[model samples]
Target: MKKLFLTLFLLSGLLVTASCNNDNKKDKKETETVEKETVEVKEEKVVKTPTIVGVAAANENFTTLVAAVKAAGLVETLNGDGPFTVFAPVNDAFAKLPEGTVDGLLKPESKETLTAVLTYHVVSGKFMAADVVKAISDGGGTFTITTVQGGTLTASLDGDSVILTDAKGGKSKVILTDVSASNGVIHAIDTVVMP
Candidate 1:
């Protein structure tokens, strides 16, 4: 009888211990799960915004422009903090130049010309299609933007496209418009219109 009593007492104690251990383990697991969730939230907060030219740089199609940007030493400027609007001319745009024009411009001595040409394509602020149209409408006839080249270029909305009238009275159509970048916007042009 005493032995039976002793056995029952021991069993109860063991069960109690087991239950306490299970409770401790469950509490520990909950704590670990909460810690993991906190870590994941912290990681999400560190996600960085992409650069403006990062997209264009990855594009195989913009190789010509990429080279020009590098040669003109304006890559860092474009990559910097700005909401600039760039009128990017495509490979076909470069093709419109006379023979050896592009090559000549890329040379060290022609940095001024290259810089001017490149900067002429860029405006200091972010000017979208809506803003441009509004400006033109406000202007009554047409709006003129003085290029970095010391020449004037006319900006007018032709249907939906933003047409650039160069200094020589030559017109170049905006092929693709409103390419968003980190620092600015890019409007692709088919022909490099001189101003």
Candidate 2:
């Protein structure tokens, strides 16, 4: 009777230990699943969209424009809470200007002129490509946009592309449009539009 009781006790203890081990495995799996979900949520939250200035600064194609904006002291202004619409000119667009023109504009004494030039590229409100096209269609195939610098830019269509005619009667074609930013939008042009 003693031997039988001891054997029974040992078997019960082993069974209980085996059951606890199984429960531990289940708990571990649950913990691992929760941790995996937490990590996934964290990864999703890490992606952040930059502002207009930040976007331009991050892009290699906008290096010249970014440098000009910085030289003009418009970085802080552009980064403000404005829904500005910018007709951003790329590096090649800046190259289209006469030689030494960009260097001359970057001078400290040229801050006023540079500011004017930069501001001319920006409109006060956000105007997406669709809105611009619709406005052009409504205004007898041409839309006049008033710039932040108090200049006017004429918008018209040419083979489905938006063409901007600046104050100097120079033309720049919009190569890309609807680049979203935190405070504004950027429409890339093929040539620099002057005020």
Candidate 3:
């Protein structure tokens, strides 16, 4: 009888210990799952915003512009903490140039000229589409702004579009507007304005 009692007690103790160990394992698994979920949430919240260079680099249409910016060594300037207003020209805009024009400008010897042309598209401050429209209105139908290239660009409203005239009397129409970046805003133009 004593042996039977001892066996039953040991069996009960073993069952209790097994249940406790199972509970501990379950608790640990739950904690690990919760920790993993927390890490996932933290990763989701850490999404990085696109800078001006990032924006141009991500878009297929800006490939030519991106190359030009790299060749001109203006990538660092555009990527800097600038609240710049960039009148970005699309690939079609560069295509509109005469044959060999882009090729010639991209050469190492033409860096200065290319830099001037690229900088001509960038204004010092961040100007949204609305701000540009207001400026045009405030300036009595034409807003004259200084480019980063030290040249003057004239902005005027053509119906709903903004037209920019360059120093060399070249005009480019803004096609896409208000593409916000971490460093600035981009207005994609239909033509590459000359400096």
For model 3, give the 10-residue run with minimal summed lDDT.
42-51
Q: Model 3 over residues 133-169: C-alpha lDDT tens digits?
A: 9999999999998999999999999899899998888
**How well does model 2 score by local distance difference test?**
0.95
Q: Residue-wise lDDT of candidate 2 within 9-37, one digit each (tens)? A: 99999999999999999999999999999
lDDT of 3: 0.94
Instruction: Evaluate all candidate structures by whole-model CA lDDT and list the values in order.
Output: 0.80, 0.95, 0.94
Q: How much lDDT does candidate 1 score?
A: 0.80
Ranking according to TM-score, highest score first = 2, 1, 3
Q: Write the per-residue lDDT of candidate 1 for residues 84-114, one digit (tens) a residue.
A: 7777888888888899999999988888788
Report clashes for each candidate as comma-separated counts. Answer: 1, 0, 0
Off by over 4 Å in 2: 1-10, 36-45
The better-scoring model by TM-score among 1 and 3 is: 1
TM-score of 2: 0.83
Strongest candidate by TM-score: 2
How far residue 115's Cα lies from its native spot in candidate 3, in Å, is 0.3
